[model samples]
Target: MKTIAVLGLGKIGSLAAVLLRQAGLQVTGFDQAAKALHDIPVLSDDISSPEVLKCLCADHDAVLSCLPYHLNAMVAAAAHQAGIHYFDLTEDVSTTGFIRELSARGNSLMAPQCGLAPGFVGIVGASLVAGFDECRSLRMRVGALPQNPTGLMGYAFNWSPEGVVNEYLNDCEVIEDGERKLVSAMEWLETLYIDGVKLEAFTTSGGLGTMCETYHGRIANLDYKSMRYPGHVQLMNFFFHELLMRERRDIAGEILTNAKPPVDQDVVYVHVAAEGLVSGALRRSEFVRTYRPIEIGGKPRTAIAWTTSASVVAVIEMVRNGSLPQNGFLKQEDIPLDRFLETDTGRLFN
Candidate 1:
């Protein structure tokens, strides 16, 4: 069995460690808060110390980082120096660029943005794109929403509040007219119905990581958006643009964190649609999935936590089994959707 060290024993990391252990992989968890879960062994150490991070990664076959986006660079560097594979659930584009640079110089695999939006959505989008002879347009949308929302925002904090703020403030990347371009977040708003529920989608940053570069000249129009209920975007626009919260992102994050209630009974919605020429006719392909909270390792976990963790863990399993490249920067689109769904970890998203 391969030994894997998981850094940051927070909600997602704790569940990931449990899933890894249940899969027969030796798991060691580390966190600064001294947090411990049911059966996983944890080390309470300062991960900010370079020596501590190196020591923890030196002996493990691979290290999965569940820490905040800013802390990923240090852990990724340590993993590279230790010659161990590195995986993370970061949706930060700058952090992923740093990891990609590290992967170019290192001999181990580095995979970032291994979560719901950029992870599985990319896989599904790629599959849809592959079915087309001449791809014209592609749109990917994903959301983690409360089953019963009672807040004014019509949303709950199912994941990191900081991540939510960052996506709203950063510029989104897209391919328009077969050219790569940067667009403002929260723009190009559109409404769509899913399962008889009306929801809205808008441009979001880092959700389409590296796909713009991959399909730049091939697809005429390509973009990724975050799905939310109607009126959510208007309130956010008022908060960030009208109220100048974008200038004070830290305060904005704190305000959202303190105000928004965290919901465990949430649902993850994924939808990818592609329109292009198939054979000799114009056709469209789509993939849609909705996931609810489920029990793992005899403990109940939220839909966001399990889905995000499952994606990274499934990629790790593929790398360990020689299905994915062992040494290089890995893209989520490179993992086929069907093959991924067949894995024990990836089955959760199915």
Candidate 2:
């Protein structure tokens, strides 16, 4: 069995630990909070120090981080020194670039952005561009939303508040006219109509992954953004930038998390569209997916869990089976979409 060490026993980490154990991997879970993993049997150690984490990861085949972006560099460094493959769900651009640099000196794979948008969305977009000639443009959008809204914001706490704040405050990377550029956050506001629902989306950081850099000089236009209900973006802009809550983000995050009720019922929206020439004719292809709450392990798992956990699981299988290239930085687009969606674990996304 392939032993895996999952760092951080937060929300995503707990779900991943359970799923990985079910997949027959000897899972060792580490987290600061002892109460978080009381129900799980793998909480035998605490990864409090970098040296301790390095030793723990040395005995495992891989190390998966579900910690915040601030901890990714340390985790990746430890994994590099231990010669174990590393994976994370961070959307931070600079952190990812640093990991890319770390990958050059290691004998292990360092794959970041292994979550919904940066992970699965990138794979789907790459699949659309496959076997196509004269590619025109590609647009990708994803969202984790509450199934029913009762609050004024029309949403619930489905994911990390810090992550949402980062998306709004950071400069989003996009491709325009085949050139990579940085656009101000909360600027490219646009309304989108999906499934008869009038939703809104705008510029957000880290959603584009390495697509902008990868597709530069190839595709004319490529962009990724977060999907929200109408009026959400304007309200956030007012609070984050206008009201200068960006200066006091921790308080803002606390306010939002405290006010926003957590909901068990949720939905994940996925839409990837590509326009190009096929067989000497102009054509466009799209993949639209919607996933709802499902019961797993006799308990309900949110759509985000289903999507995000499925992503890392797919990559883990790829690396374990030699299907994915090892010993370097691996981008999400490097994985084939069809092969991903066809995997036993990836079927959760389907």
Writing each residue's lDDT as its tens digit, candidate 2 over 60-151 gives 88989998888899888888888988999999999999999999998888999988878989999998988578788998888788878665
Tens-place lDDT digits, model 1, residues 242-277: 999999987898888678868889988888899999
Native-referenced Cα lDDT, model 1: 0.89
Among the numbered candidates, top lDDT falls to 1
lDDT of each: 0.89, 0.83
List TM-score per model, in order: 0.98, 0.95
Off by over 4 Å in 2: 35-40, 44-46
Count of clashing pairs, candidate 1:
0
In model 1, the clashing pairs are none
Pairs that clash in candidate 2: none
For model 2, the local distance difference test gives 0.83
CA shift at 206, candidate 2, in angstroms?
0.2
